[model samples]
Target chain A: MRALVVEDYHPLRAAIAQALRGEGFAVDESGDGEEGAWFARGTPFDIIILDLGLPKLDGLEVLRQMRARGDQAHVLIVTARDRVEDRCAGLDAGADDYLVKPFAVPELLSRVRALLRRAYARKDPVLRIADLAIDTATHRVQRGSQDIELSQREYTLLEFLALRAGELVTREDIRSHLYDFRSESGSNVIDVYIGYLRKKIERDDLPRLLTTRRGHGYILGPA
Target chain B: MRSLRWRIALAGGALAALMVLAGGAGLAFYLQHTGEQRLRVLAASQLQALAHGLEFEHGGIELHSLPESGLGWALYKHDGSLLAGSAWPGMAPPGSKLAAPAVTRITTPEGQAGMLASGWFQPDEDDRTGGGEISASLVFSTADIDREQTGLLLSCLAVSVLTASLAALLLAAVLRHMLRPHTDLAEKIAALEPQCRGQRISTATLPAELVPVAERINGLCDRLEQSYQLAATFHAAAAHELRNPLAGLRATIEVAAGPGGDPASALATCHQIVRRMEARVANLLLAARLDAGQVEVRRDEVDVNDLLVQAWEAQATRAADRGLEALWDLQGSGIASADPEAVRMLLANLIDNAISHADRPGAVRLQATTTDSWVTVEITNPSSLDGERAARLVERGRRGASTSSDARHAGLGMGVCCGLAELLKGRFSVSADGRELRAVLTLPEAAEFTYW
Candidate 1:
């Protein structure tokens, strides 16, 4: 649910960061290859969008180092250099996907959604538990033939938990995925958002899919 | 209508023909004159011999005719009466007086040409058989000699024509062989591309004399290839430069115009993108002009200290806005013979680079020095750039590792600085350590000073 964008162009980098943040994946971005690589190596980001021509170090070198350290974050290459050889070199160095610049933000969001599904080992775009169905692509949710609507933050919280259903997720993990570097650590924001999501998805007639594990964190689905 | 080769051959043949005719004509004339002289001498001696036999016997000259050696002879008295002789028809009218000896060509009655010698001969006036002077003439037919001379002339003409024809053929072949290199060279030149990138014509197989032409062509090819490469690099660099701003402009518009965006922030972003594009375009245009030698520098007396202070003011404002410290050390005031606007431009680029690359909150420093004949300016900034990275900063479109600012559209300041320094007839260089990057500009001191 967390993403990293490693682009150097200010306007494009900012735009991509905003788009990813808008898509409900907590986004962190850097304008240099060295910093990007450092962040990728240390963080448990689910995906990374990398630009090859980066300052301080090349993007390929960053990918190489990250992979050498066995950091398995799925990386997507986004660059203006669309030449065949440049694409090949970026991919060969361990990029999971490649996108040229001036890309449609919608397409980029869809690709991220697909990658996130793959990470969760879900072949279907819709994550389902019993009678509840959540369309990951469209951000629509339904429970036992009843439609459910939720706020952006509430939806992001529900999806994160649903993707990792049957397991416990820590507060720190939720905080990291739901916020950016510039956001203040308010500590109570995640629980408040969780309460909002619970109200919308839990119906009286539907089997309980959202749960809390005492003394630890939260879990979703059958357990 | 003749080709060049044929014309040459014809000229050669004509010269040969003229030489042969002149030589043959002279020889024929001399031979004919000698033959006539011999005929005349025979006639004169015969008359003398007949006179020697005369002793006034029978009151007139009588002599052994010597059986007429293909010559006819006659003697006439002063009264125009023939004394003793035989006459031939058409032999110079008999009454014609022969006062002195002469030889001439005459036509015999048979219409064939003959040589006649006429004279009054008086025998040596002593010794046996004293003879008296008498007017006489001798006529000898020249039919055989004339025929022979004509034959010689005809042979000369034949030989001349034949030799000229042969020489003409030889000359044409030799000319074609000699000029073969020209054709070969033309074909090679024709095959060459105007922007000929790599291929070069082989000069080794050319004739030695035409080797220089081929070499010159190869040299021209080298220039064309270099020009082509320059154009290509310029084009790619221009595109690389334009692509970033274009992406920025498009993405910013898209983000701001979307339903979830705010118009106020979008307006601000649009303004920033426009400003960035304007600055980039100006820098690229200047770089292009400088490279093409289209920029002209107007030299005037410029106060180095003032220029330094002005540049520092602009850069300091930018640094302060970013929460960084800027320091200036001005010393050794002097003058430089350079364009004021150009110097301002150079300083702006250098100071801008320093401020942008300086560590997020680190200090930037500017220093100036003036020696007896040189003026130097330097800027140092705390940075992550090392010697290797610093060395490449001046390359077109090469950005360094500082993210305090957008480096994706970086290296323009470095390019502008380096190019301006060259135009000012100065040297620009960079040095960096682990913690600091330094740029230096050293210029020649101006002699004239105008106080303001």
Candidate 2:
């Protein structure tokens, strides 16, 4: 998954982006509301963290523009404005969730998790494809009662593919979800990470679950 | 019904009563004098009538004016002997010789108080009395004079009391009518709120007599409104100031303690925020001291050149980071009897402001000049602000830009520098011509004194 953080305070923005990246979500960042709004229009993000006290434009204005443009990314309000009225206004302004500042990192992460879950309509944190199992909560994979370890990049590729196990996810879709605004990735890196994921999860003894369709995209299923 | 109204009425009633009483006394005195003169003249006329009716040739000089009007008359010689007498019922003639025309209080036959007159009057050459005296003294009782005087005085007092009461009532009514505006003004004042911008004492609608009072009240309210606005602004600014660093602090702690966070970066942020907060708190303390009027001026010999170098060194990195060059043209080594801390703060503030607003790759120039009487320091930087902004830059909470979005000094540097300069007997000024902003601090040179 990919998430964007739009906050003015540098340390807070950096910390949120770092925590999201640690959680296997590629995070794009904007230091101000204007840039944040522009990023929202240009990028396809699954979730967005917004701060109200942003320079150039307000977070609410950015949210308004995003909604006006029909961008359906789950927006979580992370602001210093803790007033109940501000919370109500943010929610009314199409905010998916509201989190006041000085919030615990785990709480923010859980809220983001909840929002993403609601967005994708995935009730379970663990995805299953026949004999292969991937816990989306902790990025742990197991196949036929055998625990498997994967690198951060390889694990992200697997999670993205497993979330849409029955459907075909194109290379562009995989690339958009794998890398953030800060990182520009070519097609070869995605293919290389998919190769690494195949080696780890698709054992010769078991039925191959992670497979690729010719001239289409990669899919995670027993095919 | 108010005490003020009652007091006014009481004062008016007292003055009115005094005036009425004085007028009544004057009228009574004049009436009494006129009555006494009329009685004296009537007495003389009666004496003449008595002399005219006297028949001295027979029956021992009959007095035709006696028993005629209840007037008692007697003709006495020089030895107190009655030459001729005519007495009314129970009326007695005086047995003393008459010296001159005299009017005295005497008792009539009815025991009533009356005016009596006795004098020597020339009678007709015909038979008047048995004596060959050149003048026959006549005495007569005054009739009805006392009753008439008492009646006149009583009437004057009655009219005075009635008129005074009416005048007092009229005065009370007029006073009530005249003070209506004052009462209305009081009500308006009672409803006024000094903090409200709309509430004001209506000087234009007030009476002319109290226009000045209303104007003063309005002026006081205006001052109060201004102070209230300033206090509100200060309160908001203080909150923002506190919240800014608090946000940074919380974020730093969260970032350091959170998973996959960089401790080094958080440590740096914490240090930076701590330093900025300390500076802000110190400035607030100084402002409090300034407000309390407890600023003690230190008479210390300060090296301006050293202070300037330190301030320049502190700001040079920021200037260079923004691709700006900080250049110092040290014309002279300025020295003065100044507070070292104040001088250092002033230099730091000026240089920091210059560096913060300097265009990227532009030049920030500092110049110091010392004369026999003054030590001047000037710092100039490329700026986009107009001359008007530069002029008011020294005002508290005033910044180079119109908005608070700029991350420069947070609007606490130049204003405090100006205040400190003033406390050190220095003149601080800013000059901007759109292209360049220059701040000048001209401080008086103190006499060299070594008490250490």
Candidate 3:
């Protein structure tokens, strides 16, 4: 999963970014609203963490502009404005969730995960395809009675594909969701990660759950 | 008369009653006087007719015809002796001689009140008395006049009492009608809720006389609302200032507690965050104390040069981190008689502001000079703030355009510095010139002060 943090405070922004990155998310950060808006407009982020008090442009205006331009990212407002009216205004202005400052990082991460789930139209924290189970809350995967261990990058890619189980996911989609702006965009990186995921999740005794369409994309369910 | 309406009504009613009493008395007196004069004229006419009717055909004179039944007449000689017609007992006294026509109040034989007229008159020519002059007296009963005057007085009294009562009621009713708007205004003011925004006494339904009063109350309400809004904004700003650092502390702790997290760096950042929060809270408390005039001042000889060096060194790390260079020029003895702590706080805030807001890769300049009785310190730095923003930089809770760039600053440094300068009996001012922002503090020299 990918996310964008638009907070003005440096320490807080860095901390939130680091926490999200640790939770297997491709996190991008901006310290001001203008740059945050620019990043939101240019990229397809699964979740956008926004602060109300930002320099150059207000967070509400950025959200308004983003919604006006038809960017459908789930926005989670993280601000120091704890007033009821502030919360209501933030939610009314295209925000998926409102979290006041001084909040617990675990709660923020939970809300971010919930928003990502809502974006994929999934209500349960765990995604299932036949016998393959992916627990989004813990980033753990299991097939039948066997537990599987995967790297962070491998887990993030698998979770993205599992969220859209039985649907075609393009390589461009994988690249956008798995890699942030700072990461190098190399060709065949998606195939290389997919091979690693297949080696771990696929076994000779179980039916293959991952399949690739010729010259098209990859899907996470039976063809 | 504690109530205005009652006061006005009672005053008006009392005045009306007084006027009615005075008019009633005057009318009663005039009516009595006129009634007595009419009785006197009746008596004189009756006595003259009796004299004209007198005849001397026999030894005694007789009236030509009997006088009216209510009239009592008597003919008397010049010697004051009753001759023929009868009169009231006091009409012709034996020793009293009738020399001229006179009217007097007398009692009739029946004890009825009467008016008597007595005078000497010529008898008929063929029937003359001893000297051709006869004195006659006529008594006219005044019982009717007394009854009419009594009735008139009673009627006047009754009318006066009735009119006074009616006047009182009318006056009270009119006054109440006139003061209805005032009553409504009082009720409206009493019902006003202080927390309700835009609540005001409506002047549209008020009388012209009360419009100004209502307008003044509305104006006061407007001012109170503005004060409330200002307080709310200040509170929100203070909360934001505190909560940002708290969030940073919490996030840092959470991250440092995670797998492979570096606890040492996290502790350092946490300490920094706490320190920043402490400074912000201290600034807030100082601002409050300064506003309430609760801060104490002590006169001490303080070296401005040393204070500047300490302030600069304290912020040297921040300055270096921001890639800002510092330069200083000290001239003369930079000594001032002021509160040492106050001076230190002021200098630290100014220098910190200079470093925080100074353009990166630029220089911050500090200059100190001493005149005959004053010590002046000036801090100048390259800034992108416009003149308008620089002018308002010292205002409480006002931040710069790049508010997001500096999280450690709560926008209270310059304001606290301004307050401390005032507490120390110094002048502080900020100005913007092109791309440079400057702050100057002037304090009294040590020689110009006496021990406090």
Among these predictions, the greatest lDDT belongs to 3
**Candidate 1 on B1-452: residue-level lDDT in tens?**
85655676678767866776677677767776786677677656655565555544445555555434346767665555566677765443335456546667777766767777667655444422324445667776667777887787688667766776776677778888977777778878999877887878898789888889999989989988977765665565565566666766677677666658666876777776676567667777887787677889888777777887787785565678656776778677658888888888788777767776664577787788888777898888887877877877777545322322224444666777788888888889888997898999887788766676
Give DockQ: model 1. Answer: 0.25
**Deviation from native of the Cα of residue B316 in model 3, angstroms:** 3.8
List the lowest-lDDT window of 10 residues for candidate 3 chain B. B399-408
Q: What interface RMSD does every candidate have? A: 4.5, 3.5, 3.2
lDDT per residue for candidate 3 within B112-204, as digits (tens), equals 887778887666556645765567777777777788889999999899999999999989888888898999999999988876488999888
1 against 3, candidate with superior TM-score: 3
DockQ of each: 0.25, 0.27, 0.48
Which candidate, 2 or 3, would have the higher TM-score against the true structure?
3
Ranking by TM-score: 3, 1, 2
Which parts of model 3 are misplaced by more than 4 Å? A88-93, A170-172, A181-193, A212-217, B66-71, B74-137, B143-226, B254-264, B289-300, B318-332, B355-384, B399-410, B419-452
Count of clashes in candidate 2: 1
* Candidate 2: docking tier: acceptable
Interface RMSD for model 2 amounts to 3.5
Residue B1 lDDT (model 2): 53
After superposing all C-alphas onto the true structure, candidate 3 shows an RMSD in angstroms of 4.8
**Residue A1, candidate 1: how far off, in angstroms?**
5.0
- TM-score between candidate 3 and the true structure: 0.81
How big is the positional error of residue B274 in model 2, measured in Å on the Cα after superposition? 1.0
